[model samples]
Target: MIDRVPAQFRGVADGVVAVAAADPRFLAVIVNGSVANGQPDEWSDLDLVVVCADPYRSEVVAQGKDFAAAAGPLLVAFTGEHVGEPRLLIALYGPPVIHVDLKFMGLGDLGERVEDGLVLWQRHDSVQQQLDATSAAWPQPDAQWIEDRFWVWIHYVAAKIGRGELFEAVDGLGMIRSAALVPSIVARRTDRPTGVRRIEQLAPEMVPALARTVAMPDRADCLRALRAAVELYVEVRGDDVVQQTEAEKAVLGYLDGFPA
Candidate 1:
């Protein structure tokens, strides 16, 4: 299984596996993301799911930095609280620096996964059995959910632009790209709504339009980018999804007031 990892990452991967196997508290280590899927490239980070004994979950999480440091020269490490998963320790390692994500969890957490990771090492068949019992389901975007918030978000972006807060306006534009447009565009082909992940490969035809949504710091350019985002959203959001008509009308009118 270590051979499946890219050449650059194999050493670190093997080191981590061996470290986890030697520890009684750590139950298993599963590799997920691009590396597990056999599609790793230079930019891909090592994503490891470290399953520990239920009783040791808290202790293991607390000592996450120590555990990760055992695998390599950990440059800096921190829990992924910002991304909502405190169990995850994101670390950078090396003279030849590499990014690694170690998501510490118990065997109980295996069933609720988005993808089936390759189990690099495990104490028993319990991990495999738990994975086999349930199918992986990546989250899909809800059209209604996006629709409900889209207009309000558009208004917010417009407000930032109107107030001459170009940075805020640009950030708002990014939110639209990642939250609304990227998913809608990616969903057209993969049915999986990834937020700007390999979007060029998935939907190259839409890249130019998507590129237009990125704004410069200037006022007119920001408004232009926002308009591009709004247009792109309308184009991608399918007809079947109900539109928020009054809000859309109000927001569009407000946006039109801005001189691009």
Candidate 2:
């Protein structure tokens, strides 16, 4: 599979796979994202999940630096922000400076992760069924999931606005987009809910316009973007949001209570 992608990424993949295959602490290693499901291209990062037995989970995760060293000369390493699972080491390697993400998890919990993951190595056959039946498809956001969160998120942002906290408001807006709006917009499509990353390539029809929703800390600008986000959500989702009308209206009216 490394041969399919650009030359720069192949060495990184080669090294990681070699190191992972030789590690006794791990039960299996899975390759996910583009390499797992899509055709190769120039830009791609290696997304690997290292499935460890419960006894070795913590010790293995602590060896992230060693993993990086094994991948190649480590340039820099850091823990990534929690999207959901808080178990991953993010690193960049020098000379080529390729990005590598190493997610560590126990063997039992491996089946719960829903993504298109192609198991590169499996030390034991107990979880063979798990890999063969991986949920690997990108699921569309359920309308109920959005409805439950959207109204509350509006209030969360409104509170940030009320407190005069522009930075939190900005970050809150991004969370709502990534969590609710973008996924629904590109539902049934191959697009990932990656905030505004590669918007032109992934969500061209919807996100280019949504980019205008970003705003300054000022009340009027934040409210302006907030309103735009609502309009886009409704336009894309329609009847799915009808139940949210009264709650949304309550907040829409509540926005006026803030200084503008």
Candidate 3:
């Protein structure tokens, strides 16, 4: 994965890592994601985690782009919409147009997020020991969590149908898919996938269902997709027949509003 990165990228990563490794504020420097796994490609994003020591943790996160600019020519930087990680700095680098993601994480917050990272540098044995003590496992989304959201999400789609917002209705399907459906599918397997980031690779079988879940603007097709999503979520996630029945009834009621 690391090998697949462009040569310029190598230099950039090296520079960034070197800068962070030397900083007293940062305790460790590690590379992970596709690059660390040795499967990087032209489109692969650079994921670098900078373990900030206690004193400078807040300062580092608040100064996201400021710190990232030290590594190279960062044209622009923004905070990523990362679901779990908050201190993420999504940066665009140039002359050559490279994308680098820098996360300023603290020791207490790292948790299971640093499992497979190849440590480029560490402050000392003490730092390594601290890293080792923290779990490398990501917590899985559980049943109650998905169940809580699934019912409301089904209603969201139904309300969209009532409003004749086919575009919004179709888009609402994705909310259910990512939040509930994908997690349900992943939980059925033995692997410890954090989320559906690699759903295509992790569960290719479900891709077609995603296509089927997208509905046409017409009422019949919208209802059909609603049914498909409900059935799939129920099938993969175990039947909450009560919720399913309620959703079915509500969708049917909405569909009846269309002229026969």
Specify the highest-lDDT model's number: 1
Candidate 2 overall lDDT versus native: 0.73
Instruction: Quantify all predictions' global Cα lDDT against the true fold.
Output: 0.88, 0.73, 0.75
Query: What are the runs in model 3 whose C-alpha is more than 4 Å off?
Result: 1-8, 81-84, 112-114, 194-196, 216-220, 239-260
> Which 10-residue window in model 2 sums to the lowest lDDT?
188-197
Q: Which residue pairs show collisions in model 1?
A: none
Q: What lDDT score is found at residue 26 in candidate 2?
A: 71
How displaced is residue 140 in candidate 2, in Å? 4.1
Return the TM-score for each candidate structure. 0.96, 0.80, 0.83
In terms of lDDT, the poorest run of 10 residues in model 3 is 238-247
Cα displacement (Å) at residue 225, model 2:
1.4
CA lDDT, candidate 1, residue 173: 92
* Candidate 2 runs further than 4 Å off: 119-129, 137-140, 190-199, 238-242, 256-259
Better of 1 and 2 by TM-score: 1
In model 1, the runs with Cα more than 4 Å from the true position are: none
Candidate 3 collision pairs: 1-38, 1-39
Q: Ranking by lDDT, best first? A: 1, 3, 2
